[model samples]
Target chain A: MSGYHIAIVGATGAVGSKMMEMLEEATFPIESVTLLASKRSAGKVKNFKGMELVIEETTPDSFEGIDIALFSAGGGISKQFAPEAVKRGAVVIDNTSAYRMDLNVPLVVPEVNEEALRTHQGIIANPNCSTIQMMVALEPIRKKYGLKRIIVSTYQAVSGAGISAIKEMEDQAQHMLNKEGYEANILPCSGDQKHFPIAFNALPQIDVFSDAGYTYEEWKMMNETKKIMADETIKVAATCVRIPVVSGHSESIYFEVEDELATVFGIQQELMIAPGVVLQDDPDTQTYPTPLTAVGKKETFVGRIRKDLDEDKGFHMWVVSDNLLKGAAWNSIQIAESLHKLDLVKI
Target chain B: MSGYHIAIVGATGAVGSKMMEMLEEATFPIESVTLLASKRSAGKVKNFKGMELVIEETTPDSFEGIDIALFSAGGGISKQFAPEAVKRGAVVIDNTSAYRMDLNVPLVVPEVNEEALRTHQGIIANPNCSTIQMMVALEPIRKKYGLKRIIVSTYQAVSGAGISAIKEMEDQAQHMLNKEGYEANILPCSGDQKHFPIAFNALPQIDVFSDAGYTYEEWKMMNETKKIMADETIKVAATCVRIPVVSGHSESIYFEVEDELATVFGIQQELMIAPGVVLQDDPDTQTYPTPLTAVGKKETFVGRIRKDLDEDKGFHMWVVSDNLLKGAAWNSIQIAESLHKLDLVKI
Candidate 1:
């Protein structure tokens, strides 16, 4: 092949479609593309550029000629097919939490840890949606001032839960607005015992709760940030909340910097020129980032930067990005591009 | 003529009307009632206990027969007429931010600082809505374990702003859903120079920016928590956000208690017996307090109780309450009930 043959697992899914859409925009050399999904969704057809690609049932044979595989299916699919793809010489970039904390697999958010791509042994991991955007926004600041502790409270979009959750939000909102009743089953996590209404309401539990009372989604954020940033001593806490919005995930972040001299202006000036970050703070003009405004595009938007009123080393800022884009699909594509840029993948 | 005559300043306002409704449910002796508002709102007839009372344009003479006045008018109105009402022999329970911080005035959350009401000099100040709910939820725990520090992120409702802000949110949401544009003018504090949309989005700034880039609303939370809790050395920080919700305010609170052995169960036990607080922390059933579920409730709802993974003395909770009821009107009424109970209101 003249260029890399890429295979997209979970082709009919939200993030998979987004991956194809983002691939068209990025100038990466893709010789061919394959779409794969479960047997139930196998016959589905999706469009990439002007071509119609039919989704084939994902199997061990699905990655024979693929150089790079992007997997966004459920954890079971990734656990089953990712290693199979790796066995056939295709480097699998997983979008689930299946291998993120795996010591062997390099967890990468291209803007934060591109160098990690070089050590990947046939498989690499894209971080959790919330963690990826946060990593992109905080990486530069961490590099300059050094991070002491991070406390984040997220206002996440329903789209991060999947397409059904999005529909659930819209349908529930309409039902609630009309003073009717609708059963909420897919949200808060379909696998979880109870489902709460997300239309015009916020749910504190993002994924299944762990033994420690933190949701798995929250645990992912706490651990993944540390692994991706290559720091163990740094303390991270997250309170993940799901709001009615469909695409963007917004975070209220409070972090203490090791360097006491790091001013809000200094952080802003650095973020202004930093990669994958867009600074949108202007209190005078009432300018700040919101989920509705951050629906599309790649960069993480940050604003409402202020030094904490009590703590001299503490600073707070608002960080937001399209959860489906920079948070997931775009980040995977960026990792694929990074593999190429760093000469880590021989296509 | 027999019982204390109650007058409602800003009787046409959201909180003022809520005060009237709360008064209907609370067991308080009212011999007669007077409704007062601005000149523009004067002559507006509102029903109270099946009696239609015409709103009178507020003047010093309006307080002649008024033994107790509940002031929910804007700070400017309260600043102008509250002293006049007090001078005319009415105990003014002000809901504006004007007198809450006045050392001479009692900033009471009722549950946390009801004793402060005994120190009032005619005007007993109601703590901010967001602060009131947190105080109600935390006071029980603070009594058992003692509190060291608190960090909070709020999901505040539009009704806290005013009637116009609620209408603006509804109008803007419908317009945006219909794919039309609407101008946002009365949220994040109407007195602020600019305003932003609170429909399907989050605005980090709640009130106007004070020095150090913290909003006045944020400052109110930080300072009011200490003032109402009557502890000057306890550290408190707040990042207040406005959401599209109509009535209740939700806060994600992280606090450090003085006792290191404080278990989530112990905290929950304290809250279970606590007055004006409801503990709903069953994560298995996805039972948590959201704004929608908290509307029109007088008691503060607390849930999502968990011990912090890193800090031994730290714990996380979600606190929600109707900003109009327990936050504003109900708190004001509770204070009135307190004054009456304490024999401080002898008309």
Candidate 2:
């Protein structure tokens, strides 16, 4: 943990750049930092701390002496390079879907499942942005009340797709205002067959739909919740939607607990003490968590807590968090810290 | 029905302007059109059918010779002026919440409960925008397969609040982009104590929270659904969220039907032929309804239809419609058409 050689894969991408920023802010004890990306992004300069680090082309030989590799590249790149990094004895923390649901790979959110990091062999998978924030807000309640069922509808930001999606939104909005036609090229899903404009709109499909009629994004939340919580009996359903927001992901969650006596006040009390969570549920003060206010912040904000009138054991809450921070880079860095504290990262 | 004199209250507001446009498009054999507003907007001029109409201040005597009066002002104005219109032998279509659940006032969506217009004594109540779009999308399904329950999450547009909310969203987004500090004055709820910026964000509380733990917007959807569908046994719950979108309202609806054997294809077929509904549920083509696409359109768009994995009786769909058109103006004009068709209008 004193002096480690670290490599950040996909260094030119959105999450990759954020990871570099977070590492600088956290000032991790690194002997050397290598920035790696595809051949197209090679030779690009990325500023870290007080030094301008040039991005290098990623290859199998690039992980020769790296102690830790953080992968934020696409799933294909992760699938191709992550195993190579692990083979070179580097602990890989992948931010792609390549290994998230793998039986051997631990999907970690530091606030919710830091203990799971103890079992990671060489690679740890970061959960989806929307799922990570929701688990952070709900884990405290789940620990106290014994969660049984969860139904969530996510209003996710455009940045969850990437920097290109944000630019497309801005450009499309400007074109719309100027009475010009602008083609949508980067959303509902980047890899999907077609794109839809998200400026001043909502798209229900966050990822390509699978055979069972659920988008990959929704399925990711469902399976990732089960894996992170280590509970097979908990029922989870998700409807992932893309809104025009830039950073924070907001979720409307309806949850049912095994304990029927859990009240709204009890849930609020639990969230008040939860680490990395802020309670903003004062009705008289007109206080509630909104994505605009939660942007650029690290904490998961929870509010609008109320008991369901029909279901005795059910409650509803609104959760908001900066998707780029707690959902991606910040969580990845926190996991690295957890690994260090647990003495699981080997040099 | 020939040469009827009509008046529009709140003519300067968002819905009122849309109502005026719809009246012009419908070309409803009007002898004269009177625009009425508050003292501030009284002297303004509005164009209808190539003629300039001076907006008059709304008062008791404003409805003296009016055959029909459309009210889009707030509840206080509706409560004060509706009876005056009715007393002057004019049929009143009130777009506010003052008399929606009055039990005496017939709440109607022309596509769903046009028959209810036959029983209206004087004042007819228009359902909430979210409720109107959902009812239009679900009524055909309800008729084919008796509905039991509904759960909806709304991605509502800022224009649903008014023109000021739209302006606030535009201003806030530009201010945020330019790194300038600006106040939030019209979002979440204009009448509420505090305002939050809606640009690049999602606000969970649409209106003030009521005693039942649901926002006023949610309550309006729940009650209005029951009244329009005329089914007291149907259970409905809603979580209404205001997004940065400007025009159309989108909803994710989960419904349970008495017919458990209905397939997704069956529901799609039903929605395709249903009146005032356009089915856009092709995942292969990546075609779906969005607010930006539904802007100026009059039809309610339904897509993303799928069956619940575990529940045989459950189905999910995404519903989108122009809040100003089908939700307000066109619905009002349709009611007027229904009145004429039923010979209910006394001109």
TM-score of chain A, cand. 1 = 0.99
Q: List model 1 lDDT by residue over B1-347, tens digit each.
A: 26789999999989999988988776768898899999999999999889989999999899996888999998999999999999998999999999888999989977787887777789988889998999999889999999998889998888888999877877786776667888888876787787777877888888888767778898999999898888998888888888767788999898999998899999989999999988888877778888878887788999989988888899989899999999999889888888888889868
Model 2 Cα lDDT, one tens digit per residue, B65-129: 99999999899999999999999999999888899999889999988899999889899998888
lDDT of each: 0.88, 0.88
The estimated TM-scores of all candidates read 0.97, 0.96
- Candidate 2 residue runs with Cα over 4 Å from true position: none
Error of 2 at A177 (Å): 3.1
Q: Candidate 2 lDDT, tens digit per residue, A1-347?
A: 46778899988888999998888766447888999998999999989889989999999999999988999989999999999999999999998899999999999988888888878889999898988988998899999989988878889999989999999998887776656888899899888888888887899899898766779998999899999999987888788899999889999888889898798888989999999999999878878898878988889999989887667787788899999989999888888878777878789
Colliding pairs, model 2? none
- Stretches of candidate 1 off by over 4 Å are none
Error of 1 at B37 (Å): 1.8
What lDDT score is found at residue B89 in candidate 1?
Answer: 89
**In candidate 1, how many Å is residue A46 off?**
2.5
